[model samples]
Target chain A: MPFLDEVEAAIPALRRYAHALLRDRSAADDLVQDCLERALSRRILWRRQGDVKPWLFRILLNLCRDEHRRRAARPVLVPIDSVSEAGGSGGQEEFMNLREVHRAMGQLPEDQRAALLLVSLEGMSLGEAAQVLGIPDGTLASRLARARAALRRTTCRAPDRPDDVRGHRP
Target chain B: MTERKPIDDDLLVRLHHGTAAERAELEALAARDPDIRARLTDWQRQDAAIRALYGPVAEEPVPHRQLRLFDRPARRWPRVSRIAATIGLIALGAAGGWFAARLAQPPARGADLVAEALQTHATYSVEVAHPVEVPATDEAHMIRWLSKRLGHRIAPPDLRGFGFQLIGGRVVPSATGAAAVMMYEDDIGRRVTLFVTRESGQAETEFRYSGNGAARGFWWIEDGLGCAVVGDLPVDTLRAISVSAYHDLIDA
Candidate 1:
């Protein structure tokens, strides 16, 4: 019962993370479904000591990677209308820019995106992110740096935002 | 006055990540240097934007219908039943086929040899001049030659009562190895052959009847030897010929 309750509690976050990774509502839902099913089936394999949230995210991310690999050979076209709809909100230009950032994120190499998402978006510590991605912490840090640089270049935003907490000192 | 050292690339990356201790160092560095503080601000904003784009995805609702984790009762039973029935039918069909084959050919060990002899006799006895390799006039040589080849002594049975004479014998292959068939002819040109070979290691004396083309045969094995009488004669005539041949061969 505790395991099931844990899984249920993780579902919303799983959906959110999957949606970020896949960028398609249906595909994200399907990924979440697969992750949940796998988690349920292999419930006994979960370690009781750690947070189930990261474990669930790890499963979902691995499934997403597998899905990406399977679809790697096939050419995928994101419809122009979906892109426009994603970019339409003028009040949230930054959010729209964020969506473009995600599109750029999608184009970033999978390992880099995975490293970035695990650390920055999912709020995982570098050590935990490294463990989840099955890489060394140093390697994780390098990947995160590369991913951040790539995102900055791809989005082409100014180096500083006035509203940011750490204002430009120079 | 002297100066201190610079940060390495690994340390710069760590500074970009900015742990609690690293943040304090960055604040102190910002008080001392403006350029490093500006880079830190850019890094922080970039981190924030990346977080904003992906952070809310985890809160989205998971569509239950897409999962297919739960099965519908209407669809489940039929598939299982169909698979079970298919397996059952395959097993039943195999058992039935095996039973039918067993009934058609009983477990008699000498049946195959007897059948093979009857088939061979019926096939070759219809030949005119080539029915026997050596003519009956050379009876001793024919017997000795056929006996040497067949690994058993073979004497042509006298079918005088059946109005047939031994024309001669020839060596041929048999199911039990080499065999000899001694040809005989009646007055009307009807020919019958007494097919002989060593018993195929069976103890029972069993008779079988077989027909091919217009020829009928009565074959039996006894005392480590097998014999078949084949001709175009009626059933009674074939039986009579076979009995007379059997008596003469056994007596000899």
Candidate 2:
């Protein structure tokens, strides 16, 4: 397997994770391209024997973090002008049911979102997820739990819940 | 950060993967506590829906600009090909030794093929409208379009005799170049996809059936083009359709 193929093979997973992190297809795509370009340009940094999937994920997450920092420090410019380009596409109807949950997911803190996505969505074990997120396993676990709790803080507020049940565990 | 009481972690895990009976028992126990049941149901639903929604992104074509990374001039090597080859074998060994443990980790070969088919099925099958790139009314144009993109002359077999009519087709990205996906549907709107990708090797054994997730199909290599007919139909029905298409391709 050439190094190129190995990297190419991981592109799908990278794109999927990037889309989940960034919440926009085109933006996620650009992030994936950026991360892959960076990795390919500096292939020497990757050990030959190391699994490239996690390593690529680590680069992707790092880029996401950098992107967040940049957005926070700089008043972000909205690309409102670009909206005209696809304005007529009229966008297909996204499921409103999913929209409710997606909105809640977007509200999650970035760290907790990353942790939950890796373990719960990507099927990664806690230790491997920690390596990709560059955090201790314990921290990852806490983040995962907090993310679940915070996410359900809204959706799980069923009207059916009894008032006294708030004190009990599910 | 403001803190809230932590939900029992083990309970959450069980809710994520617990038996139906266990879940029922838990629900019964929590009947007095609807908050707990709602929370558990929400978590489990989120976990499943997240994948169902986003997993198809993996099948979206990798943009050509990124793929062009390989077309660039080669960088100087460290002569570590030996180590890479050795490590590759070791990786395969480990993967095979404990496939149960690493099933979540993506594999390099047939898994990619079947997984992509499954994802494609999941994506287009659910469309209420515009399920195909080319509508069946323009089947001729669709074939020409896909063939031109794939750089190989291709045609989709007419399966009207079997009650499946050509709905349309599209060109999708594949490992080597591109694949052609021709979709067909029955009267009730059940869709089946015929996937054709150019293979470097000669045709393989007659036909083999394999499945990933909800997509089941019979895949075979014929005249250096690997073809598969995938759908959610039962194996026998799919196999019958695959055989008909296989004969059509051979005749063409």
TM-score of each: 0.47, 0.46
lDDT of each: 0.63, 0.66
| lDDT per residue as tens, model 1, A1-170 | 34455667777667656655566767767788877776654443354455787778777776676566556779687432254322232434543365666577777887877777666666777767776776777777667666655666667743454322122211
Candidate 2 on B129-244: residue-level lDDT in tens?
A: 86788887898898789888766678898789878989888777877578888898999888898888776554233345566556776665534567777897765567668777
- Weakest 10 consecutive residues, lDDT, candidate 1 chain A? A161-170
* TM-scores (chain A) of the candidates: 0.76, 0.77
In angstroms, give how far residue A155 of model 1 lies from its true place: 2.7
Model 1 TM-score is 0.47
In model 1 chain B, which range of ten residues has the least summed lDDT? B1-10
List, residue by residue over B1-252, the lDDT tens digit for candidate 1.
013333322344555455788757757876776555655565566556655655555444446663344343224323344336345434533234235334546336445655666666666677765877899999989989988887666788878878998888887787678888888888988888788888645663434455554666666665467777887787667766776776556544
For each candidate, the DockQ is 0.12, 0.11
